[model samples]
Target: MTQQEPAPWDPALAPADADRRLHAPAAARNRDAILSVLRSVLPPAGTVLEIASGSGEHAIHFASALPDLTFRPSDPAPEALASIAGWTTQAGATNVLPPLRLDATDSAWPGTLPPGETPAAILCINMIHIAPWAATEGLLRGAGALLPTGAPLILYGPFRRPGRPLEPGNAAFDASLRERDPAFGLRDLGEVTALAAAAGFGTPEVIEMPANNLTVVFGKQAGR
Candidate 1:
């Protein structure tokens, strides 16, 4: 008999180790909300690679909930890798793969893409808005190479537009990001769409998510 799965957001689990670092506490808070969309969008069974999986909070959370699927979480930072290992150990999650050393800026992905298989899905949440445009270009292009036709490149984050009224919080956030580095700020949706097309992803389906964010799903083009 198949074992029943644990709830995605549970209050009754044993405590996490204090030494584990979770840089984005907000990830845990928003995890359940994200998973609701993921459950609907993600394939029933296949490998899912999460890019820039800071602290591995989403890796463990989603893996636990979607036990039928395997989750591979990757980040370039060593500190993030350590946190991911810690979270995997703490959660006792079997479906989650070891944290991979992947930088979205790299042309070649680090981990072995499964034999005779592309990753069923490529996910990146809360990354492009914070990183430089080159990173965004790399992400879309690299993901294009790693996914099959119809596969999804799921991006979740805030975006900007020239004519649209900016949300007060997002405007302030964008200002802060620009202050830190003028090159970084919320990206425009139309600009991102063009990048996706150049990278071989088809038209994107934009979904409004909670907390002023959007989920954009772009499909890979037919036949490479």
Candidate 2:
């Protein structure tokens, strides 16, 4: 069988340890900022399903800080799953569950969760822009199926906003992403919002973050 190449954005740094914990430099830089928004948006108590949880650093940090809420981190890569498990053990974070092997493009995602553990929120950080558009579509569809009315689906990433020129850094980053994979590049915010709306979500609340990133929150509509 032919081996598939790892994603260009996959974490490449790791500490010298047997537990297989990988490190992403960006995760450490952005976790606290992401957590700040999560504090006010997340449900007080319930599971928060995180998709494409790259290095597991964000999961460990968030789980440690938000002990009231359980975090379920998942990724499609075997290395990523190992890294998440390693970080969970290293941090001794009881709130963070073992990582699941989940692909954002999979239609069977609703069945991938642990029994009776419906998530109160779904979070995807720095994923859509690095993944195929189908992943974004599938993510919305899965979140729509799983979350209860009024639950939030939060996404954090660089996006192209209508009328606003892309920030220089983000513009360069977008180019690099597309150079690596033509299907991957910053998505237009208006398009993502429209897709969410079609999937039974309300208009999103867009919050600006450091490094030209955004935290966009869409709530599941009632009676959908």
**What TM-score would every model get versus the actual structure?**
0.87, 0.94
Candidate 1 lDDT by residue in tens digits, 125-216: 88886678888988988898778788889998778855796677677778877886887888999999998998898888888766667788
User: For model 2, how does the per-residue alpha-carbon lDDT over 1-224 read when each residue is reduced to its tens digit?
Assistant: 11211232465445524778888777887789999999999999999999999878898999999999999999999888988998899988899998889998998987899889899999998899999999999999999999999999999988899999887777888888899899999999999999999889999999988777889999999987
For this target, which candidate reaches the highest lDDT against the unseen true structure?
A: 2
Looking at model 2, report the run of 10 residues with the lowest lDDT sum. 1-10
Misplaced by over 4 Å in model 1 are 1-18, 110-117
* lDDT for each candidate structure: 0.79, 0.88
- Report clash pairs, candidate 2: none
Instruction: Give the number of the best model, judged by TM-score.
Output: 2
Count clashing pairs, candidate 1.
Answer: 0
214: Cα error in model 2, Å: 0.3
